[model samples]
Every structure is written in structure tokens, then in C-alpha cells.
Target chain A: MKVLEAETYQAGEVHRFEAAGQEFVYLAPAGGIFGISAAAAAVLETMGAAGRRMDELRAEMRAAGFSAGDVEEALEELIEARVLERPRTLPPPRQKMPERFPLQSLVMNLTNQCNLSCKYCYEYGEDKVATPDGKPKFMDWETAKASVDFFLQDSAGRERLHITFFGGETLMNFPLLKKVVDYAEAAAGAQGRAVDFSLTTNATLLTPAIIGFLADKRIGVTVSIDGPPDMNKLRVFANGRPSYDVIAPKIRELLARHRTRPVGARVTLTAEVTDCIRIFRHLTEDLGFQEVGFAPVTSSQKNLVTIGSGKMDSILEQFCALADEYLAAALENRQHAFSNVTDTIAELHEGVNKSHPCGAALGLVGVGPSGDIAPCHRFVDSDTHKLGNVFTGIDRSKQADFLERGHIDAKYDCHTCWARPLCAGGCHHEAYVRYGDTGHPNLHYCDWIRTWTDKCLRVYGAIAAQNPGFLEHFERRKAS
Target chain B: MKHLRAVNRKAVRVAGEIDAAAADVHALQEGAPPQPKPVPHYPVGCTIVFSPGWEVDSSGGTAGLCQPAERDLYDCYATCFWPAQVPDHLNNYPDWTKKCASATKDWREIDLVFP
Candidate 1:
């Protein structure tokens, strides 16, 4: 028989909160949440900041009316869960940056020309990153084919590949887009690999034939629309006429025709477009979109359409209100198309700890119209962030510098932030636009992101306690 | 369940005692309270009773769970060993961990389904 010996234990970092009338702890070391018992809480409280030896802890538990066996069991459970630990063993090493990460997806920029002259347009407006001179406005077939073959070759052992059509307006080069899809499908099929296709379109050029083809191919679609006519005043044509009337009917046709995949709306939240709920309702209830996601416009601080810090409060409040609705819907096992909340909740469910702001330039990259490779879609035509050309292949030296600089370890401010795992110091493009350096953290978004992450954590906790089964459903939804 | 027994022995011991007591009371005119038998392992479809379980282990106990379940989640996804509960990343969601190389660390990079 083994004899239990007295040992000293130090408590691990934990974020304790109440959700759905249950006390829970977000165990930082383990990156998991567990509904702790009253006894467990008592044990932690008694242990306090200085921690306690086994003898002291056992005596305290006995005084608190817990049996010896129960006390030992709880201690074992807590220790095993990593809520308590031996005084000092070296902390686990940080995740090392992989020497060679595989490529899985690419954002193919079909064109650099759009009919709409949206005021907040990142690609063509006042904040434009100066589209490099002499590049083709519309992607030619040769460049498109090389891009496809580049993706196939780069993502060598990967069984599944993904291509996302992007642009100043993706559908501007619809003819080329069709040819590229056909060529990619046949090319991928020959290799016994599967390629998933999706596209972000401005919806002005969605003809009946295009819509039918999109539906048949089951291509995922994200339509760029702000809201109802009044809200979309910024999204106007070169003649300064609102594009709502033109795109509305076309979007409806596309939505009506595209049945194979869920259609989503991507709203650019600027200074004027702050009513998230109103916009979400208009797009989901009225426009019949399956999901609606919002991104605060990222550009230079002086840009007129930039979402100001003052207005961020309102945006966050509206987000919280919508999140409450999402929680309500989730409790009943129904999905609410408030995608911002949906995405954050999903991240929380998986206990996400990000190393970079996003998948950009990691598993995914962007191919510009002229076959120039960039970090992501937003950087497609930007001369500064050009990674390489599809023909010559990715410049690993430049790629390494970008990744190393963007890594969470390099972000000093993020080292102490609890939400770093989710934000990873915020978007790389946003950081570059705001601070002129991709390595810089988006300090402007720190408070907003922390508050938002906390709220999402609460929502995750509530759903977990009330309807854990729904999490399983959500997991399946994401996986499927 | 076997893995649970190996991972958390004490919990299984306590649970086994409880199960045995219940079995003794619920037995149908049994002699010597019928000794507890080990569950036989076999190749089965989505074997929830064999390996990693969510809430309850094969012993019908709470003690054998992976203390913080996230620790073993990626292993399960990678091997497709336990598909009764979680998605098998090997087949169903191959791109699930494309950005998340280290499940214990980079779980945030796991992709979510979007339109």
C-alpha cells in the first residue's frame, strides 16, 4: 500500500466567475473551464495567495466539514486539472514556430476594378495602398492558371484545398472567374484532391448565368452590403449614385438561386454605420442572408470613414445586446446569424490561444490579379506586403520576417493580456494601417477587444452550463 | 473506458465500489453477488465505451475524465480514435487544425464554419 505524504501546492492562475447560477473557473494553465464545486471553491479560498501544505489543507477541509476521503479526492482532482500544482516545476515551453508550415488555402484576387466607388473602399479609395503600376486590372487566364497550379503545388500533400475569389469587386471579372473555377476543378480532380470554392462579391455584376453557375458549383458566397438603401449611401457608383437599387435585386436573385451553400453578408462598420443590430436585422431578416458578419473598417486614422474610438463604445454595446440574443437562441438549440458572436463563441468553445492575429500568410495567402502573392486578400495589390509571385514561389526570407514579427511572443503588450489568445494583438493589416508596422499591436482595439472577449466568455459559460449539448451541435456545424 | 482506467485509477476504484454495491443490491437472485467483469475490447463503430468519453466513462463514473478535456482533444481529432462525440479531423474536417499545429497552444487558430 502506498502511503500519502504531505506536500506543498501552489494554486495556478484561474478566472472565476458565475454563469447560469453555477460557479466556474477558467483554468488558465489547462485552457479549459470546469464547474467547480462549493468544496473546491472553499479549498481554493483557504489555500489563498500563499498556498498550503497537504496537512494544513486536510485540516482546513476537515474543519469545513468535508470528509478526509472527499478532501483527498478533491485535491487530486484539482491537482490533476492543473488548478493546483507543485511549488515550482519549470513552466511548459512556449509553442515553437514551425520551420515549414503547410499551405492549404489561397485568396485569388480576380480583378482590381469595381463599378462602385464606395467612400470606404480600401483598395481604390483615398486610403488606397497605391496599386502597383503596370499590373493588369483584370486577372488574365495565364496568371489565373499559374495561381491555381501554384496552390496545387505549394499545398502538396494536403488532400483538401480551398480557393476564395476576391477583388476590388470579385464579379467584375466573372468570365475569367468561371474559367479559373473550371480549370481548378479539373486540375484538382486529376490529382485526386478536393477543392472548396468561395467568393466575396459586391453583387452589382451578378447576372442570371453567373448566379446559376455559382449555385451549381456550390460556391460559398459573401455579399458586401452595408444595409438598407439609406445605410448603403456610401456604397455608390462612379457617378456618385447609390448602388443599392442595382445590387439589391441582383443579390436577391443570387440568394434565391444559390441553394447549395449558405450565403453571408459582410458589413463594413464605419463611423456612420454603427447600428450593428439594425444592420444585422436588415440583412438577415429582410435580405434573407443565412449569416451576417461585421468588420470595423481598417484604414489610416485620418480616413473620414474610420470608426472612431468614441463610437466604439456604442458598437460594443450593440454587440453585447446582439450577443444576448445569440445566447437566447443557442439555449433553445437554434442558430442566430449574428456571426461576430457566433465566431467568438466558437473560439471560446475550443479554448483558442492565437499565435498570430489570423491565418493570413500561414496556412493561407493571397494571389493578386498579376500573380503577385501577398500575405492576405487585403494586401493583394499593396506593393509593400508583396510576398512573392506565383511563378517564382514564396520568398521564404520575407515570409519568415513577417511571421516572426507578427508572432504573439514578439508583442510585448499582449504577453500580459488574458485575451491575447483570441486577439493575438489584433489584425496584422489593421496594425500596419494604424501604426505603419505589421509587428505593432493594435493598441486602439485593446480595450474594445478585451471587453468583447469577456462578454463572449460569459456567453460561452452560460450556454455551457445551460445547454452543453448545443456546443456539440455547434462543433458539428463548424466541422460539417 | 480502458484508457480512463489507466489515466485515473483512483476514480475508477471509487466508482467500481459504488457500481459493485449497486449491482449487489440489484442482482437477480445471484450467488456471491456476481463478480464484476471487465468489458471486452472490440473494433466497433464510434466506440464511446472503449476509449475517451465526455461526461461519463465506461465505468459509469465521472472521475476518469481528462481533467481539463482540452488536453486530449487534439489527439482524438488527429487520430480519429474517438468519433462518437467529437468530429474526426482525419476524415471529416481535415482543415480543422490547419492553422492550429499545437492543439494545447494554438487552439484559437482552429477554423470555424462560416458562410
Candidate 2:
């Protein structure tokens, strides 16, 4: 079944093919087959064998004293049956993956180096280790420039670009970080594009100067704070002292400086469900942060304990209960928004056809010190998802094929399931590191996404009932 | 007697010069009763005059004299009535009869009548 001829449309393409005993119509690009009646087919033949514009065909039938309405209905039936293909420009022939738009965030690790040595840190993880030298390294200015250039090329026509600085602590390499941001902003301006900046920091190195720079640049910040001092014991420095006292004051100062900008917290769940909820509440209610997100620490080789489905279920239940609390707080405050992972899940449920829900790994390219481009910051060391090197620039031709290989060979079982489109086969790096294959769907994350989706629909309904106009405005903003 | 004369007039006008092969193919394709030989009726210079109140039956399924034998009638009717429906006001004449009288004054005319 080769497509001998095809006409592309915005909705989908249509192709005419001869297979088995008869001629068949197929929706091209996606490749769904449709069945049209013999009478309708004869009418089509009379109009022209090659093809005619729909309106012209309709008029010709009408002038020839045929039922215009019947012909129109038959055309639609043919379309639905996959007998006719709608016309559309095909994706770039050379690329391995189709271009996906409206990317959510791009994660850029300013430097793989970090100050604190957390037990669960990827740098210290058995799978990915720093060089024998104890000193943390930084990304040079030239590589950073190339990274920005690569991003602009890959993300052409994307509505907004969010550059999220990550690392051991992105703030530790402040000079190179500033230079990268400056170059990106300048490049974006030259191309007439809009770019937003964000950072996920431990908040240990945040100072008055750092706060001022972030505030001036309008960078959204998410600080990592596990629980109170006791629960945060796992995230300690090389000297093995608690980091809470050091990070807390800096978080307060940065939040004070950028009151209007979004300042959120991320807490990693290492203990039981009860402890996780306690940590979440303490971070949001006690610390006065508007929003907080929770995630389990990645199961690196150093931490050989497998994350079981039982633990994952308990965490989801706790998170769902916490989401209810967060919603209540937002409503009570009348103007606060929490980093409800539910929103991202809800967008997925709404059938947004993104390659991945966590858009980090696709649109955003992370530059290793050696100038290799990993899919994103998280999978910097993994060979499976390493897109290409930035020095040669992005080979656009290989994108589609590369993505197809990743999708097919992904270890995440979810990739084969119907929900694959919504979850995007789960995190590739997480699957590769934990399970030795990217194709396996992380059931833990899948459960979390399902729970979050249900909670979001519930919250969204309540919000819509209270103010019908809110949804309208939100949808409008999404469209624009 | 009047109907026979009308039939003769039509037959005389269309007789002879008809392609025998085309007629044979037409007959074979129809696969029905054989058609009678056509007889030309009108002279070369005679004019056609449609009877007043002889309006075409536009309603479908009538099986009337003016109705077409094909599944569709609009195309046939449009072709048949083009000259008759040419408005008199456009030609500054009192009626279609008057328009035809003035218009064919300088040209030879042929009249067609169907029963």
C-alpha cells in the first residue's frame, strides 16, 4: 500500500489508492481508510478523475441538475470514511519528528556544578558522576551562545520560549548565567520573538544582588525546600549540616523582592505519605509561598531501592488530598495560584496534541560542557535521548526520525497504550536510568497524572461555576 | 388529421443527412422498441410559432408531452425555451410574436413544432 497520490489539508490529507479488488480513499498523513458509496464515486468520476475543488464540484453537479445537498453529504461521508484526504503541507521530510508548537518550558542547566551534595543528586548518582575533581564546572559563554542559537532555530514560530536555568545550583554560576540570558534575550529580540526566563534553585546561594537581578529580569523562580529542618535532613551540604536555615532566609528575601512574580516551591517526597502532606502544608501555609509542587526523587543507581507501585499510589492519594487543600487556599486568598500539577494534567486531558506534557525534553535542548545537546537538563548524561551536538547546529532533517525511534524504543509501557499521546511515554531519562529502557511507562508517574487530571477537572468545574467568564478568559489567553 | 400534419412537418425538416451509424448505435443502446423513420415536414423558409397558453409542465412525474424522458428536466427545458423566453421588453416589441416577426425579417427562419 503505497500512496500513489495524495492531497494535503489542514485537518488531514486524503489519498486515492488501488488495493485488493477495488479503489479506496484514505486519509493521508494519519492514514485512516474511508468508504464512499458507488453512486457518489460515479459523481466524483464525472466531475474529474484528477480532482476538483469542493465548491466547483458542487456547482457543476448543481448545474447538471443533480442534488447538490446529496453530493455535499457524500463528500463529508467520504472524508470521515478516509476515502478522501484533506490537503495539508506534509512535515519536513528529513526530520525524524514533526514540529510541535507552544512549548511550556525549556530547561537549561547553566552549570552541571552544584554547591550542596544531596544524596539524591544526579551529579553524585552512580549513573552520572562528576569528574574525579571535586570542583564544580561552569558552561562557557561560547557554548551558551550556541545553545541560544540552537533553541531559536528549533523553536521557530513557537509562541513563547521559557528558559529555565537548572544545575547543582544555577545561581552559583551567576556570571555565565547572566551572559547566557543576555545573549538569548538579544537573539530573541533580533528575531522578533518573546522569551521568558525561570530558575529552579536550591536557594542556598540567593542574595540581595541575585534577587535584584531576578526581579529586574522578571524571572519566575521555584525554590527547592523539602520540609521543616528535620524533614530536610536528606538535603545536606558536604559538611552534613541541614540546609534549611541557610535556604529559608534567602527564599524570604527573594520572595519579598519579587512579590508580583510567581515564586513557587518544590518538595521531594522521600518519606511516608503523611510526612509528604505535612511538608507540602508547611511549605505553602507556613512559608507563605503562593504555590508548591511535589515529586519523588529520581531512582538513580546510587539509590537502588525501586519505587514500588504501592508507594506511588499512596503518594497520589496524599497529593490529591493536598490539591483539595491548595484549591481551598487559593479561593480563600481570592488571588493566589498554586503550582497544581493538575493544570498540566488537565491540559493533557483537554486533548492538546503535544509530543510531551512536560515539554522540557523536546523543545528545550541542554548543552553539556562538551557541547553535546541532551534532550533536556534531566537527561544530560543518558546516551539514548542525546539529540545531537550543538556545535554542528541542529540537523532539522533527523528530528522526526530520531523522535520516532525514541517513541518506538521507549521502555515506558504507556507509549504503546492509548493514553500515550497525553503522557508522551513518560520521562525518557527516568525510564532509561531506572529500567534500562526509555520505552517503559513509569506507572508511578502515570498514576500521579491520572489523579491530578481528575482533581483539576473538579477544581476547574467549581471555578467555572463561580465565574463563568474565568474559563473564557483563560481559553482566550491560551489561544493568543 | 392536424396531428398527422404536424408530425409530417417535423419529419420533413429533420429527414435525410442523419448518420446511419449513429442512429444504429443509439437504437442499440436504447435496447427498446424500434424508432419510426423520421419525415421532414417544414419548408426551409417557414417560421415556428408556439401556441399561446402552451406553457411547459415544470412539475416532475407528470409524463406530459413537454416533459423530458431523462431523469432530469431542467437542462432540457432551459434549452427548449431559450428563444421563447427572450423578453419582448428587451427588444421593444409588444410580445414574443411581435419580437420574432421583427427579428426574423432580414433572415431565413425554421419553425419546430412538437406533439
Q: After superposing candidate 2 on the true structure, give the runs of residues whose Cα lies further than 4 Å from its correct spot.
A: A1-106, A129-136, A272-274, A300-308, A326-337, A345-350, A381-385, A395-402, A408-419, A444-448, A461-467, A476-480, B1-115
Q: For residues B15-100, what per-residue lDDT tens digits would candidate 2 score against the true structure?
A: 22122323432322132213443431211211123212222222211235343222121222234444442223333432323223
- lDDT score, residue A200, model 1? 94
Q: Candidate 1, residue B12: CA error in Å?
A: 17
**Model 2 CAPRI quality:** incorrect
Cα error of candidate 1 at position A84, Å: 3.2
Best by TM-score: 1
Q: Output the number of the DockQ-best candidate.
A: 1
The whole-model lDDT of each prediction reads 0.77, 0.55
In the range A256-296, model 2's lDDT, one tens digit per residue, is 88875778888776634236677776776777777777767
